[model samples]
Target: MRKEIHLEHSSLKYPLPEQFVQELSEELAFMNEYPSGGSYKTLSAKLAEYTDIAPDCILPANGSDEVIESITRAFGNRLILIPIPTFSQYEVSAERNGLNKKFVPCLEGHNYRLVYCEEDLKKASLIWICNPNNPTGSSIPREEIKRVLDIAPGIVAVDECNYEYLGESVVDLIEQYPNLAISRSFSKNFGLAGLRLGFAVSSSKNIVEIARYGQHFRVNKMAERAGIKVLKYLDYFQNIWQEIARTRDFFIAGLKGLNIMVLPSKTNFVLVDFTTEEKARKIWNFLRGEKVFTVAGWEQEFSGLDNQYLRFTISNQEEMSFVLELLKRFPENTS
Candidate 1:
């Protein structure tokens, strides 16, 4: 049997620099000490310098996963409205916290673009929207996001884990709308997924309340040191983001040439539709045999349309080319 490609993986396929590794090694001496109670203070100061928000507005967590959990905990038992086919964690978090979930399914014929009408916004106590949405890799327009924020007075969590690729963010909107909270992850563009560090940017009042739910030393000491080092090489990070975007466009164009229908993506991944579920499964197995992995389509209550779609991440030029070549020779196994 061929080894299966782990489609659930969602991080950049790059290694951290030797310098970053060295810095992490130096921090090993402090590993025995507990992380600062307010883990976000120094990290937040650096982020605030970059985002122009006060350090107090930033709340660091073990990962954005924990940040989502903290928010759900803070707003317990409220009706949560999520636009369907998004990050599964939103639903998982809601269920774990005993919050009721109401989903607004994205229109199938319309490539799953967010259809957040005023009525949908009115129904949610909290709304989680992924800009450059996951699995599908489509981005909601900035104006549309603002409209949702305006219509929905409830907490709106914008997960911008893939924000570096898109170069658009609503971080500035946090000051104007108390209900808005933006989640940023060092995992994606920064290549720190294993480190599991991320932070939420929101108003100071909201941060204070959310911080109450978060543990004093939620983030590990090593991850904090890694984050601080990454900040120092911010320019290098930007260059990598640009390279990923370039490679993404190149790969999408190649997919189009092969008649593989791919949605326009603002993130590092592309969503391609296969002719049938069996064909998709065959391609997935073939890729796995070659050590290439991508995300499989959601196959549950939301499986009415395009159960054959697959999500592929953009990597370095050489690896991306190899994957594309392998895709070009993909066997026609519709059975």
Candidate 2:
């Protein structure tokens, strides 16, 4: 039996659109052709329509991870500043490029909120802020984001992978600050994780520079077709997002009922801190033994700081209920 339930992966638990699946099946014929180089013309235009940004301002990459790497490469040798316990990719990308990394812990005793000082921002050549931050699922307020932008002299990259869950965005601020860039992904809301599609929205100048670092025909041909198909079903995607938000809140409430300390989240997952590390580990093992996968806080190198902290993703109500029921019975396994 597999030792893990693979619950740490972030994406919708629901099915992809039937139309998208069907169209993708049909578009498999195009796999024989090479992907279009530079900006994906059709997909870029479709994204432009969705984001209300010019096509030239978008740069598509095989995945947002690649987009991050490209940004790190282009900037070259600037200090990368990040808030603690955010996405790991930012630090990993910086290390891979031999760039210095500075981490300022988010608001202590305040659930990891963005709390960097102006001096911190001034020293950074690139600042990566994950809106609706990963692992913690806490969002830095828009006003705080604006404050960071105002003081930072370098480029600011906002990773909005979970933005749809929050229903807010800073994309509008792009025009106001030439140094700001927004990275978005199709993996989360669009259910396109397997397709590995992501893009960056920024000033035309920045987009052009990032595009130069991107490999030719890097995006798979089939993924582009899938992207175009998914864009047409935007309504379906929106509906799914609403359902996810509803279920996520319901699940969070259930966790609270069980006395698990859940951090407030605008993202699709909850960060739960168990009262004791022993309890957290025992419950984590019990859930895995029951074939219900969840993320154990110890799985990541940075996670052990809080042995009680576990990250849980919201799927459907039924799954949430099962997880909650198991937690309610946690006392039985505590011995």
Candidate 3:
């Protein structure tokens, strides 16, 4: 069978281990009943140990998206503040829940620094921060995040879907700042995208609030088992981060050699700038013709921020080798 590669959505490029897949398959015998709280209880305990937070402080959801939606619902009265060119779900969740939103645009030019004046920061309630931000992969330092947490009177929520990749976590701050919530996903690190597993960490009081407004049974039995099983081999999952970093740097170096302006990223993907919207479109079209797909920087999710950029998830070197060969020609006939 030909190896089908996907460079979108930031799924681990590696294949799932057969042993883990078998464990989940064996769990199919129990589809008749609602997922027991016992599994949830056990998983919560496990995650508590993993996140260093008490079980009561953790709220499991179908995925990070659902957790975000619930948070938006719980705090719907507050005005939502989000940085542009981020995961669009924050905006979508706010719209779905009828929360008013204001986007703070990234500082003009390539850096995309998230800057807001005191008045801008004080306005409204919730602030959505995506660390190692999607598409651009630019990260805000811990001190900067802490500053936001201190200044914002409203809840300061963080989308940390790529947290495991870089070990940059504010989950530790949950105890100190009851107003902060960290959203995390197993889909990126554990290769469980299809399983749709994720959770949130916050003060126990906040967890109670999330449960108050969220779905009653957010996690399924299979997803619970899949997450628990994956945790058993946490070391294997952690190593994938290193492997991806190496592959990302290798590909980035090659792109730089070709004089394609690329941004610094700590996540599993990189943004390639082709200088003009038309040039970027040609590259996007060229890759599509090669049966490869990439996220156009002009997509609505990017809020039309980087029209000449493309978000390409870094797969393994073998798959990247194929992509690189095609990318080598991105400038040939288009000029």
Candidate 4:
């Protein structure tokens, strides 16, 4: 059987710290018990310590997906503004709650930077910003986010699930701006995607409201224990994050050497622009035949450009080198 390489979902290629195995083993006996409800006090406290925020300001969920949904339901009664060619969940949550949504197109010529007009800012009650955005892997500037918060009448929820890769955050502004809520996940940096641990950080009041739409005991025990244990090993994951960054840069250089147009990324993935759908499909199909799977841009609802793009997750140097070699030998379309 051929070994398959999956670059579709952006989960980290590294494994969690070895200590987690013992942690989960200890949690196994408690599988019969239900998790604590009402925002999961202990888990929230651990997350609070990790994020350097008040315990009351943390709301643990199944994952960032649930966090986004809760934030959308809690504050998305009015119009919600989402920048396009970004994460699809922002749109999914808005539509699921039956709230009105506006898709703001990010500037394609400008590294896909997010731009919001004063009119849209004032009209929106909820604005979703995916920092180091998914698929595009582009980061929104701190000043830009602050500018939006200054004028936007409602919540500005920034998804920082990939923040560890870039080491940038606006979490400190949560105290200054009551409307700011940041969603983070343990999936990418912590290598705990299977455990499904994520949380929302904001003002204590905002957290209380976000908690309302959530069901009781949404976070399971294994995930709770894992979240606490992982906080102790930030140094371990920080090393891995640095390694991924290095690997990402190497991969980007290799792609560029192939004369491919690759987008700049702060996240753990790179977006490749093939300039046209035909070429993109050809490359994607070729890679798939080689047991290497990548994500196509249109599949993620990437808008504002006809150029077909593909996103590849960064792994170690050997795997990336393998990919580059595959691209080097990509079978030509003779048709």
Candidate 5:
């Protein structure tokens, strides 16, 4: 049987908009026509309106990965700076491009949060940052982000895939800093992971350069309609996100009660350290036996965690409560 509880990956587990599902179904008629590729014009305008950025500065892609890949292709010739234990893909991308890469660890004992040294900041060409970072879920301060922009030697690519909960953004900095690009995802916030839709915000000149590597028939028509509906009822979506954040706090508190060490987070997930890699694997096995799914911290991207953590994506309160109950019954490791 399939896993009964899914706390794996950072994707939102709640249902997508009912109306969007209907619209996506009805809009399937446009399947015969080609997708607009990386330059979904109207969608770019919608993103621009939502972000308060210029349409010419936005590039809507099939997914945020496309936007990131475009960054690698456009600026792959230089050194790339990445924060360790954030997302593994940035390292993979850098390696694929044969670009020199540096993985800077955050301030000592900051739970793998982002911290940059001035000297290290001046040595790279492209800096990759994942706010409310993926595996760790640690949110770096806004001022620190501004500092990176001010000091970084070259382009800084900020992946704000989980940006909604922060209530503040450096996206506005894109216009002022031609060296910055902010990539956002609809998959997590809009509940559109199935569509694989995302967009990027940057200076007009920066986007123009990224768009040159953009290809055709990238975004599907149904996904486009769903994306439009999401923007149209954005307030409703925002409210839903607020609820998720509330649930996240509740889940963190519940985990703490179980003697688990949870990293602070402003995102929909939290990193729970089991104090040791062996303990983590034990709990992972216990949960897997119960058919609940979650991310084991052994992933190389999260090596900074020393395989001692688990990243649990938040679901509804009911689902979370059930998981917590199961975890309560977990045998304590005295090892």
Candidate 6:
């Protein structure tokens, strides 16, 4: 049987360092004890070292998902201004917390920029911006985010879950904008997606406010150990991140070479436009039959997309070349 190729979730194709297993093995003995609270002290200290921020400004969580939920629970009382064709979790969290939301048509004909009026900005109590956005894999600049921070009435949450791949951040803005909170994950760069380790970075007061909604001992012992262990190997992961970005560019080029329209991406995935929903679905079905999988645009739920674009996660060179070959074999414009 052919090996299954999963390019659905935009996770890193790289494996974790061997030292991670040894660290987790040592942690197994301490499974009986409760971990420190969600704002784990040791993990927070390490993250502070990595981010060059104060330890009090970090709120460690099970994953960025929990951080998103907590942000909504803590401050999602009024309307939330969400730019469409972005991550669905922002909307999911808003609905779960009973907050009214306004979706602005942002990504179409705009080079995937975040578009919203100052009136909407003033009325919003919370705003979610996914830097290096999901599905579309586009990024808005820090200045754009700074503009939102200036006018928004409440918390401005920036999801930097793909920051490692993009290599750009507004983390420094947290000190200047007390209402700014950034959520990051170890899942992508560190290959710890299954381990569920992520954190929120903000001003000390904002971190404290967000931590209230978190469950006591929410982070597992093993996950915490993995997070701390991985930070020591940033140099190793830095090299991997560069390689992944290069692979993503090459993959995008390969798709373009085949006359496919792919939105420029700063993340580990590309949004491929098949001109119409029919073509997108046909190729999607074809790839699945070949034991390859990708995320369909409609599957994203928040994209408000009708073209049914396909999002392909970039893998290693060999797998990417194989996918390119498969695309070459696909009979385009055939009934």
List residue ranges in candidate 3 displaced over 4 A. 1-4, 37-39, 332-335
For residues 1-335, could you state the per-residue lDDT of candidate 4 as single tens digits? 96899988888898777777777798899989888878787888888887888899899999999999999999999899988787888888888889999989885653776688999999999998889887788888999999999999899999999989878999899889998999999998888898898899999999889988888887888888888788888888888898899999999998888888888989899888887798999899899999999888657545433447888999888888999999888755212
Return whichever of 3 and 5 wins on TM-score. 3
TM-score per prediction, in order, is: 0.92, 0.94, 0.95, 0.96, 0.94, 0.96
- Model 6 per-residue lDDT tens digits across residues 1-335: 88999998877788877876777788899989887765688999998898778999998899999999999888888888888888888889888887898888777752788887899888888898999888778888888999999999799999999998887889888878988999999888888899898899999898888989988887988888888888788898898888878888899888888888889998888888888898999999999999999888767555565555888888888899999999989968322
In order, the Cα lDDT scores of the candidates are 0.79, 0.81, 0.82, 0.86, 0.79, 0.86
Q: How high a TM-score does candidate 1 get?
A: 0.92
Pairs of residues clashing in candidate 1 = none
Q: Candidate 1: where is the Cα deviation over 4 Å?
A: 1-8, 298-306, 333-335
Off by over 4 Å in 2: 1-6, 301-305, 332-335
Give the Å shift of residue 162 in candidate 5: 0.6
Highest-scoring model, TM-score: 6
Kindly report which residue stretches of model 5 are placed more than 4 angstroms away from their true locations once superposed: 1-3, 300-304, 333-335
Tens digit of lDDT per residue, candidate 5, span 154-229?
7888888888877667887876787899888888888888788888788888888888777765677777777777
Residue-wise C-alpha lDDT for candidate 1, range 124-232, written one tens digit per residue: 7788888878767788888888888899878898988788888889998988999998888888888889889988888888888778888888888888877777887
Which residue window of length 10 is worst by lDDT in model 5? 297-306
Give per-residue CA lDDT, model 2, range 59-95, as digits (tens). Answer: 8889898888988877646688878777778887888
Q: Against the true structure, what is every candidate's RMSD?
A: 2.8, 2.3, 1.9, 1.9, 1.9, 1.6
